[model samples]
Target: MTPQDSAGRGLFITFEGIDGSGKSTQARLLAEALRGLGRDVVLTREPGGSPGAEEIRALVLEGDPDRWSAETEILLFTAARRDHLERTIAPALDRGQVVICDRFADSTRMYQGLSRGDLRGLVDQLHDLMIARDPDLTVLIDMDPDTGLGRALSRNGHEERFEEFGPDLQRKMRAGFLALAREFPARFRVVDGNRAIELVAAEVREIVLDALT
Candidate 1:
């Protein structure tokens, strides 16, 4: 659905891409720009937006790469998303505030569906059964997997479960995200993310402004 078709309530915007695609940075930039324009904006991220969800995020992102089986990982992600929607997202939307999220259900679809296993059906089914709301506008920061992987690996963090999947998986994820954008053209905007941060953020700002209008 279009941003204007959100039942006249708040706008829900999400940034999506393979790991290290700079989606998180762009999400923050968009939130800052909208707030600068005097709009109420809530910045959040998936798998860890709320208290309970943050706990879930630790479980999903920590430990060995095979800490959880593919099916179990999907279930944990769904649980975290349910808590995020109930505790954080729903309240912000109710207050007519724009919500900028770093990642959302789409990440689960691509990471679990493509990276872990061929569980796209399971991802869709779980999302439909639990969290069915889609972002009004999803900005997909598209980039080459090799570059993205390099950027992601250069960072230091204990939450490297997904990043540990390496380059081949990252390539598959990039393709999956692009395919998802194609599946939801009206709600998805593909932004070239290989440019400088300022340039990419500028393009993102323009896309968000257009959606808000």
Candidate 2:
């Protein structure tokens, strides 16, 4: 358990998955559902939740696929996360509001940590030395890599640098995420993303509701 939980601070919930896994949509739906139940919810996303992080988001997410080396990217992500934690997540939790984040350090773990090389240890070291916290709950939206890649590419969005890696990376990321869930089973709840949107949303709502209780 985190210090926040033991101290009666609010819950920190994060969604994780390969690109285009519908995790973002699920995050929005879950936030809306929780608010409907009269809960105080602070819906946010990583690499851009706070103003400073948003700048970092552009740097890391846009430009060439090799815009920066994995090592450099890890440092940049950590910096943004630190700013986000101090300015946004920490205060909201202290005020006892549910902070629903679209993604967190887990993304960094898969992307910069495992993607280009085996740097999970370095990512964890920085996280432990700096952030030193984890979400109270993490929802992993699992789906086939090719389907996810196709869906993500269809968006034609500007922040498509990572998606540019194509289906191979997506497959690896999907496996990495599932492995991460197994590694932290206590804080993880995997949900299938291949189902209908409404069905997925309903399951997400139920999972979060149970956590809230």
Clashing pairs in 1: none
Which pairs clash (backbone N, Cα, C closer than 3 Å) in model 2?
Answer: none
211 Cα displacement, candidate 1 (Å): 0.8
lDDT, candidate 2, 99-165, per-residue tens: 9999999999999999989999999999999999999999999999999999999999999999999
Alpha-carbon shift of residue 204 in model 2 (angstroms): 0.9
Most accurate candidate by lDDT: 2
Say what the RMSD of model 1 is. Answer: 2.8
The per-prediction CA RMSD against the true structure, in angstroms, equals 2.8, 3.3
TM-score per candidate = 0.95, 0.95
Provide the clashing-pair count of each candidate structure: 0, 0
Model 1 has an lDDT value of 0.90
Reference-based lDDT, each prediction? 0.90, 0.92
